[model samples]
Target: MKVSFDPDVAMLLRRVAPAGVVWVLLALPSQSVYADDYPCRVALCVPSPTNPWSIAACVPALERLFDDLAHGRGWPTCEGSGVSMNYVNTPFDPCQGGLNEAGPGAWVIEGKKQPNHPTWFYTDPASYGISPSASPQQSAGGDAVANASLACVGKLMGTYRTYVGQYNRDYQEVNVAVYDQIVWQKPQSPWAIDVYQNGQFSRRVHWK
Candidate 1:
């Protein structure tokens, strides 16, 4: 008998190939098979260019996350209470006086969306102790900070996939918007990630 399979299920079977053959055979095809063909959209929220993190760090980290997801490394899970995002804090002087150094700089993975709505995964920044002038010793000149930020992006990517899969299974057009407001120290500039259901990345939109 001929059987139908959703794109995501096909992808999953491909991941575990030979070992998953039996499972794939046993799995039932989606009730609404036509839904998996629709396009999937994604958005990224960016902080103002004035924030060093946005230009010098966050962008690259985000790019890395997208590249990894496109290549298929699987997404991260958001099941616990602790913060799943990472950031690098840099001290900023608002009044131009060094006497009172206020922490107002950070680069982070805000969160992803499910279909057309936002699904926040990283909610507790304070719990992570994000502070300006805080640098990972192992990073040795921003490497550690960048890695941490990338890790956070990776987790966010996982969440994005979960939402995308749901939309695809439902045969609904996927609209994902990632918002970046985790850094209160800088102005927020949102961006987006656009991709088709066939795994084609459309474009990255940077909002003014």
Candidate 2:
């Protein structure tokens, strides 16, 4: 899972500005080559809080998390690898949004959609065996996006934590207890998501 960066890509990484740099790095000619090698597409649903600025602020962290998952774990494998990651804004509460709004618990892989599934990389302490009342430490001003992104990454990687907060009520709990349980369906329908949680397996359910 050690991805080797081409010389040009390495140079670009060092010189590019930090804001939204992940997109630029991933768009390099080398990455296109990698895509050609793998030949599959992936779309990720990143959390988008109510604050408008939060999405822009969190873009870097989201990109990094996406890259880590894509490269570190060899996800969307050669059999399923056109490799496109889309970041959709989702409200914190699943019940708050209208049909047009990207509410919580939405999921999409490739082109297929699973409207009832929790957003990919989303976390709720209670679902991971932590107390329902424990809250995450509040991030200081300007650091909120970074901290949020880190938490998402940690949860996606199966790093359990204990935290209590009022917002816990807003998050929809997903049963994915570990990262490995997130699986792609067979090659016949590679875009399908198959999840194993709490001793039960759930297949890719069409968006309602």
What TM-score quantifies how close candidate 1 is to the native fold? 0.17
Judged by lDDT, which candidate is best?
A: 2
Which is the leading candidate under TM-score?
A: 1
Q: Candidate 1 overall Cα lDDT vs. reference? A: 0.28
If scored against the real structure, what TM-score would every candidate get? 0.17, 0.16
lDDT against the true structure, each candidate:
0.28, 0.30
lDDT of 1 at 11: 43
Q: Model 1 — which ten-residue stretch has the worst lDDT?
A: 37-46
Model 2 TM-score? 0.16
Q: Count residue pairs with overlapping backbones in model 2.
A: 14
The list of candidate 2 runs beyond 4 A from truth reads 1-46, 50-54, 73-208
Question: How well is each residue in 30-127 modelled by candidate 1, as lDDT tens digits?
Answer: 42431221111011112111321243222443454445555765332222211122122333112221222112121233443335433354233322
| lDDT tens digits by residue: candidate 2, 1-208 | 4455544434434432233424332443365553443211122112111221133323343344445554665344322212233222322211111212111222311112224555553344434444444333321123233212111111232333332324646343323223312222211212223322222432221111
